[model samples]
Target: MKLAAQRLIAVALAVGLVSCTDDPPPAPKPTGLNAGTGCPEFAGSGRQIEFGGEIDAELGGVVLGAGSTGVVLAHMAGGDVCQWLPYGQQLADRGYRVLAFDFAGSGVSRGHGVPLGRQVEAAAGALRADGASRIVLAGGSMGGAAVLAAAPTLSPAPVAVVALSPPTGYQDADAAAAAPKITVPVLYGAGELETSFAESARQMYAATPSTTQRQLVLVPTSAHGVNLLNPETGSVELRDRVTQFLDSYAPPA
Candidate 1:
């Protein structure tokens, strides 16, 4: 009995020591854009794509509108590529090539643990290779920060950009630093209720050296990121507004 009791205590001590050692936290899953109201999906538009793992995707019409422009949309942290379908369809209707893809760790593209910028790079490269003469980059929240982060790295560079409710910084992406380097027209949008988010937009706008045009929109909703783009959020005119912005600057050609 004595020997058994001593062995049990030793076993307990070993288990306790193992439990105390910290294991690294699990990888984060994308959220927010995963559900809730988002722009609708096109009935029969876009297609599947494969470039390092896989990406949910769509491609716009072949003929260019005016600038021969193509647009690439990156989704928010938790959401996948489907949410952008409605807007992408609109762009397609307007004669612009539109490409939307999942960001590796999210949606159907999940589990690659790829960094966001690499995903953007891959998407943009695919778009360019597929005949996009010029490109525009757009995103919301984490996705927004991602495009902004990718701005400087684009070889031919995007003609314009739209970042809605982007963070001031994320990981290697510092908007404050990046904004100055981007020499293109930009449309920055934010909601009034989220002070930090609105402030971040303002800071990014201020940092961007826009000689031609740069507009700041303060949407009247608590919505952050792509949620601001949703009509149900009460910012009904955003769709037209974005279309107009793109028309005036990066319109298809």
Candidate 2:
């Protein structure tokens, strides 16, 4: 009887150890603003969306607000949709339907060599499908160059464009070539201390045809790209200038 009891006890211990080993580890805690394959839920009214290019790559995006004028915001290189969420929320609050997206190879998006300008085109189409009648394009750094390059080709063209710290060219996007073709109102902004970008902005402005209503704004601060829109680190004059330009050109409906 004692031998039988000991055998039962050993078997029970072995079963308990197996069960403990089989138990799964607790899920890892969320690490950043983006939790998974969807838009960050912290973006207030922003909703997760997806747009695609000719390749299998599907770009992840977020769209918010309900306005007739649509604004497509492109992020700087190495940055993602999260970079624009704060500013996008502000635009949404002001009655502009804003779509901020991750370009291929960034954020939740996929793909390797897709042209950034084409990605912007896809984003604009997504915004139009979401109910925006008028489109305004905005981008920072690499994104700025992309929007400028894409502006001249967009169907119906953008009513206005805001390029902050745009380069003459980025990957497949060529703002230099596209500038001469842009006939709509264009606002080119950059930090006076970022000499290269400031110079590029000037050159693009010069290349823009005289028929276009073009404006060049150089702020005293050294902030670059979308940093120009940051309420904390960005410039007040630059922000005000952008607001004035948007109001004058694409007034929210």
Candidate 3:
């Protein structure tokens, strides 16, 4: 009886040990998640131009029009528009060698905003220096206004002007008065909710000469600068509209 009891005790101890061994290991404490690089790097000429301390960095701008040509992409707002990889790529796909860079004090570019006219001249100079004889000036908000201010001064004048939510009357009265002088086919797009800017866009369209193929597009449910970055807010439609307008006015090679 004593021996049997001892065996039973030993078996109990063995069972307990086995049960403890079978227990799963405690879960490791979670480390914090890492930050993500927003978009992919742009691929292109890899060339950069330094104009008045602003570095107009080039990316994937080598792809030109139907004949292996390229277009100068001037991004007027702030930040490295290069980060808007999708926007640049979409334009690239449409036969544009996009020259997307920042204004001085904005992106990788080094300088700050000079006089509005000077800003336009500088941008035009950048395009001309890049060997684009027939240029298409596309701008957004401040950029749009800059392009408009710069258009008349371009040596040969830009082939077309596409302004997205451009601010009118921001500069002097002369600048506002000069908006009508843009004779090229002008395409203006704005969000329906952007009251002041939408009105400004309408004013610009109305002011332009009747000879100019002026178009005003009201993007439904889109707000100022909202669709510029967010992919979900019918940005594709906006891009298509701009591209179509550009196609109608692309300079002859």
Candidate 4:
């Protein structure tokens, strides 16, 4: 009996030790755009210009309407080529002259050293150069954060913004604090499975003081950044939601 009691105690202790071992915390959730594969084909006409290098390739934007309103699609951290191509094209088809380009280091854009703010500036410049008077800044993941960070710097100011799976404070609090400054109509979306970023999205929506027209749509059974890529499946729903938001705030002519 004594030996059996000792053996049972040892087993319990072993089980306790194993339970307390503490596996490494799960890998930090990805904050930036993750590169997928393939190149996005551009269908519109402008002038495909190289801004920096292979990464910063600026394809000529398609002019949708005679008006000055435009939408700039910002790429996530990795590159926008394969992932954002379909969505960009969809926006183009919707009659919004869209400018979709890679960041300096990530895509066809030149220079890998450009920071987030500079990328937003580049998008704004593309819009202004193309005669876009009212701009709608749209981005995914880190690109979403970039637009928020650059909001204050845009001279004419963006009329609205659409952020998909935007990270709240992965890097710092500045991005979160910038939320209040975004007074324009803002549309925010996230994957229901993306519990990691759910709180962040909520915080951003809650912090924004502008109640003009703000929305948060939690997509079910989708992964972070996947909805935009598979629009036919779930991405289409996201696009429609965004389009409706923009339609409600049609930019000034």
Alpha-carbon lDDT, every model: 0.71, 0.89, 0.59, 0.64
Q: Enumerate residue pairs that collide in model 1.
A: 30-78, 31-78, 65-252, 65-253, 66-252, 66-253, 67-252, 67-253, 68-253
Q: Candidate 2 lDDT, tens digit per residue, 140-243?
A: 99999999999999897899999999999998999999999999999999999999999999999999998899999999889999999899998899999999
Model 1 Cα lDDT, one tens digit per residue, 1-253 = 9999999999999998888786667898744223112323452445444454343332221111222588888777777666566666667777887777766556545434455665676677777766688888888888888888888777777888889889977766666678888777778888888889899999988888767377788876778877777777736665567778998988777
Query: Per-residue alpha-carbon lDDT of model 4 for 1-253, expressed as tens digits?
Result: 9999999999999998888886666788634332222442343333333332222533322233334677776666665544565665556666666666656556544454456755666667766777777788877787778777766567778888887788874343255877887777787888777786666778888888855467887777455653554645565667678767888885435
Question: What TM-score would each prediction reach against the true structure?
Answer: 0.73, 0.83, 0.68, 0.71
Question: Which 10-residue window of candidate 3 scores lowest in summed lDDT?
Answer: 31-40
Best by TM-score: 2
Q: Runs in model 3 with CA error above 4 Å?
A: 1-40, 43-46, 53-70, 83-85, 171-175, 225-231, 251-253
Candidates sorted on TM-score, descending: 2, 1, 4, 3
* lDDT score for residue 56 of model 3: 36
RMSD of each: 16.2, 8.1, 14.4, 21.5
Q: Judged by lDDT against the true structure, how good is candidate 3?
A: 0.59
Candidate achieving higher TM-score, 2 or 3: 2
Backbone clashes in candidate 3 total: 8
Q: How close is candidate 3 to the true structure, as a TM-score?
A: 0.68
Give Cα distance to truth, residue 229, candidate 4, Å.
6.5
Cα displacement (Å) at residue 34, model 3? 25
